[model samples]
Target: MRAAGRGGPVTRAAVLSAALAIVDRDGVEGLSMRRLAEAVGRDPMVIYRHVPNKAAVLDGVAEIVFAQLSVDVKDSDWTAQLRVIARDFRALALEHPHVVALLVTRPLATPLGQRPPAVVRPLEDILTLLTQAGFSGETALHIYRALFGFLYGHILNELQEVVERPEETDEVLRLGLHRLPVNEFPLLRELAPLLAHYDGAAELERGLDILLNGLAATL
Candidate 1:
């Protein structure tokens, strides 16, 4: 549906694209129907014609981001394909850190059948990848769940390592780990140096190694 604006007819894609920009700039909290209408240069009431409400707009924004994740269903090496997908997914999350929360939490709120098609496509494609590689549908589904569960955890963990004092030379000060009592949080304080230099890509590869190796053994 196109909402007639002063400049031209704003397609639903245009409306959602504007919504995505708002989310990318100010995050999910900043997005509202009113702001979206302004972004698209339309009346606030006109937004209702494109999307029913803020929830719908939020879902559309998520779909726009998730659409970037590509799946190679034809890749015969299921494990290798999964590794590539995992890395690509990680890159996508890092590229749009603000959208990471939605990427992780939206599924919990949305039932499988109710989720946006783009959000669900990766799952379907992965299932196809595994099943085509000789795994049963049930097992493929389990692998899919396990892989994504690990990914979600990894991404959230990666994004949470915010450096409080980047300019500080001391690792503890840099990570604000020194704020915790040295005696009480001995282990955490001791690891401050290691924590300060987080290598998200290396960490992701390590996790994929462990997870994929373990999953491979079962097959």
Candidate 2:
């Protein structure tokens, strides 16, 4: 896939897209310059020429994932905007479960932090929402932390579910119910069905509402 490097060489976007496809199929561990080269029908050296190394490749994947989120705070209500952002993020993570673990553990400052310009716009929108809601810069930062923590936690839990049990059986639900003594955890057992059900979008919207409402009351 080594395009002529004279005038306009292989664009970064093309390289990143190929990398994301690799991650989606083979996961972060399965990724390597050689594998990426084979997937893209390029020489391994050409892959390196576009991205400095494998770490950079992983970062590109993260950027690609974030780029998929569509949130516009200027056009939507602050709470509505935040809910959309959270939901979109949750969906993206779930779509690429293999990459979720890498995203959680990797520091943003690493390759991931070098996000494409498109990724920064969504964060700027979120920050703008927080400011409009009467939060100080510090408080806005804290809100951001809480918002992401909730999203990440939800995605991580979903990833665990996929890994531990590929099949969703009634027995799985019963095991969780058994952990809570019926006498002491009557409410929990009664609500087990709702609790066991996985709806990342709905849960994300609910959590966002709670977080924004809490922030509103505090502010």
lDDT, model 1, position 116: 83
TM-score quality measure for candidate 1: 0.92
The candidate that wins on lDDT is 1
TM-score of each: 0.92, 0.77
Q: Write one digit per residue (lDDT tens) for candidate 2, span 72-121.
A: 75644666677777777777777888878766655456553455665565
Runs in model 1 deviating more than 4 A are 1-6
In terms of lDDT, the poorest run of 10 residues in model 2 is 1-10
Model 1: weakest 10-residue lDDT segment is 1-10
lDDT of model 1 at residue 206? Answer: 91
Q: What is the alpha-carbon lDDT of model 2 when measured against the actual structure?
A: 0.69
RMSD of each: 2.3, 4.3
Local lDDT at 104 for model 2: 62
In candidate 1 the C-alpha lDDT for residue 110 amounts to: 85
Where is model 2 more than 4 Å wrong at Cα?
Answer: 1-9, 107-119, 162-169, 172-192
